[model samples]
Target: MRIIIGSKNPTKWKAVQDVFDTYQVDTLNAPSRVSSQPFSDEETREGAINRALQCAESTPGAIGIGLEGGVMYIKDQLYLCNWGALVTEDENIYTASGARIVLPIDIAEQLKAGSELGDIMDQYTRKEEVRENEGAIGIFTNDSISRRNMFVHVVKLLRGQWEYWINK
Candidate 1:
């Protein structure tokens, strides 16, 4: 089976590769058609769905996968959130969300002021391209859950759902 990842980011590619190692995986420049930094779980999940649908539309015979990271407010506090989606060849869509962590007030304020989490994280840690590597999740979780690791979990969820549908 051929898998088409709806992103060109290496971290996302690695996450899909980790879960679908036996399959032929390829990346595409699929657009999420959402905010650069999604602000809510609903919006983030929509972005993932958009990307997955776009990938599937562009590559008819392959399964399309999308991964998205964003922040959301839970009980008046901002938290980091991740979401992912998978589109089967038959056009069945599956979605799953990953772990979330509360963000510090300062970061929340910056995000509220229109700063992307990746940029804020880069400045906060003086590290370049944190999103491409460890990501905000890694920094906040102290590497217990790297960004790729979180996405891997979400992708695995999508895979499990897809497998169940196929087998059943």
Candidate 2:
């Protein structure tokens, strides 16, 4: 099977490829031509589906996959990460959980003010590109925590729980 991934993030691509690597299938990157920015839950899913479908359609008989990660507000708190979707041309779905992080109050307030978390922190701290390296945690302390690691764990569901239609 030819599988296309809809993301330029090496982390996401690696995570997805790792799952299918054991199988006798080929993989390629074809990140969604659509916007990557998160808007709403429904829109985000559509973005993923569209990308996956686009890839699937492009190769005639290939399987397309899409992964999306974004921040969400939960109970007045900022939830930093969550998985999006996995789609096939056959219209199958293999959704998974996303990484989760609790935003500190200061960060939450800044997100509430319609500012991208990293960009907002970049302005207040004036550390010159700290957000890209440190992000939310950069505001307080240096930590090894990263969304990329979190996503790897979440994407591991295909190991046991997922029933692969392509394999079937």
Candidate 3:
């Protein structure tokens, strides 16, 4: 089966590749069609769904996957959240959320000030393209869970759901 991924990011590709290892995987630059920095679970999930739908639509007969990272508020504290979506050619959609970590107060403040997490993380870690690598999760978790692994978990959830549905 051909698996179509919605982003060109290597991290997201690697996550999918890890799970769907034997499949013929392909990627296209599908837009999230949401805020560059999604501020809530709803928006983040929407972005993921949009990407998955677009990819599935673009390729008539394949499974499309989208992975998105965002932040959300819980009791006035900001937490980093990730979401993923899988859309089958038959239009079956499966969505799942991954692990989240509470952001430091300083980072939360910056997010409230309208700074995207990636940019803030880059500045915080003094690294370039952190989002495409270990990401804020890695920085916060001390590499206990890299960003790619986070997305890998999400992909596994999505793929597992799809498998269950198809087998049913």
Candidate 4:
């Protein structure tokens, strides 16, 4: 089976590859059609869905995958949120989201000021393309978990649903 990931970000691509190790994995730069820093779960999930559908349409007879990371405000606290989607050639779509982590006040403020979380994390950590590497989650967690691993977990969830659906 072939899987086409909906982003050029290596981390996301790697996550999908890791989850679906037996498949032929490829990536394309698909548009999310949402803010760089989505402020709500609905917006974030929509972006993932859009990317997945677009990528699936981009390639025939393949599974398209999308992963989107954003921030969400809940109970007056800013939390990091990540969502993932999988769309099959048959147009069956499956989605899963990662665990949310509350952000530091400083980071939250920068995000509220119209800065993307990846860029802000890069600036704060003096790193480049953190999103393509360990990512904000890794930096915050002291590398206990990486951005790739986070998406891998989300992809696993989607895979579980896909397996169940196929079996039924």
Candidate 5:
């Protein structure tokens, strides 16, 4: 199962590698750089889809992945997280479920103000170093886990039983 990821982000790509790297596959990158933009009208979903499509179209590999997050209202509170997508060489689509956690007050404001959540945190956060330590999975800030661990976890959830997915 040779896979090609659309992103060059070490943290995010490492997550994909952790799960699929062990398989009988060769993962490659797309010819062009992939975007972190949202795919749908909603930021998160839109970002995920855009990444996946752009990645697949641009890359020369069997699989391309895009993951992103946007705020969705659950009750009165809003949460943000990963909205993921998987695409195969034959254009088969597989999706990952999004799991969101609530945003801290100050952080939420910046995101609502149209700044990318990651960028805002990279500039301002409780611990200035947290921006460097954490990646999309959001482990370093609150959890004892490292960015590596979060990537592995993401890979697990996104890895599919590709053995049976014969490209028609």
Candidate 6:
């Protein structure tokens, strides 16, 4: 099987690759068609689904995967959120989200001021392409968990769902 990731980001592609290591993997630059920094869980999931569906339609006979990271407000506290989607050849779409961490007020302010999390993190850490590396999660957790690993977890969930559906 061939899996086409909706984004060219290596981190996201690696996450999917980790989960579906046996499959042939490819990456494409699929548009999310949403705000660069999604502010709500619904919008974040929407972006993932959009990317997955678009890529799946564009590449027949291949599964399309999408990964998106965003921020959300839950109970008045801002938190970082991540979502993933998988589009199968049969038009079945599976989605799952990862754990969220509360964001510091300063980071929230920067994001609110129109700075993307990746860019803000890049400037704050003085490193380029933080999103493609350890990511904000790695920085927050001191390298315990990375952005790629977070997506890996979400992809595992999606695969589990797909397995259950196929078996049933």
- CA lDDT of each prediction against the hidden true structure: 0.94, 0.58, 0.94, 0.92, 0.56, 0.92
Give lDDT for model 5. 0.56
Per-residue accuracy of model 6 over 1-104 as CA lDDT, tens digit each? 88989999988999989999999999989989999999999999999999999878877798888899999998878899999999998889999999799888
Candidate 5: tens digits of C-alpha lDDT, residues 1-168: 555565565656666777776744333443222234232325665555566666676556656676554555566665655556677767767666444567666766666666665676667644444423564345424665555555455456556534445533
Write candidate 1's Cα lDDT for 1-168 as tens digits: 889899988899999999999999999989889999999999999999999988888776999998999999989899999999999777899999999999999999999999999999999999999999999989988899999999999999999999998999
Q: Relative to the unseen true structure, what is the C-alpha lDDT of residue 151 in candidate 3, on a scale of 0 to 100? A: 98
Better candidate number, 1 or 2, judged by lDDT: 1
What TM-score does each of the candidates earn? 0.98, 0.66, 0.98, 0.98, 0.71, 0.97
Off by over 4 Å in 1: none
Worst 10 residues of 2 by lDDT: 130-139
For candidate 2, list the clashing residue pairs, or say none: 6-31, 7-31, 82-98, 83-98
lDDT of 2 by residue, 45-145 (tens): 56666666666666766666666655666777776654545556666666665546676787677666677755766786776554335445434434565
Choose 1 or 5, whichever is better by lDDT. 1
What are the per-residue Cα lDDT tens digits for candidate 3 across 1-24?
899999998899999999999998
Cα lDDT, model 6, residue 118: 96
**Could you tell which candidate, 1 or 4, scores higher by lDDT?**
1
Q: Best candidate, lDDT-wise?
A: 3
Candidate 3 lDDT: 0.94
TM value for model 6: 0.97
lDDT of 4: 0.92
Per-residue lDDT for 1-168 in model 4, tens only?
Answer: 889999999999999989999999998999999998889999999999999999889878989888999989899999999999999999999999997888999999988889999989889999899999999999989998899999999999999999899999
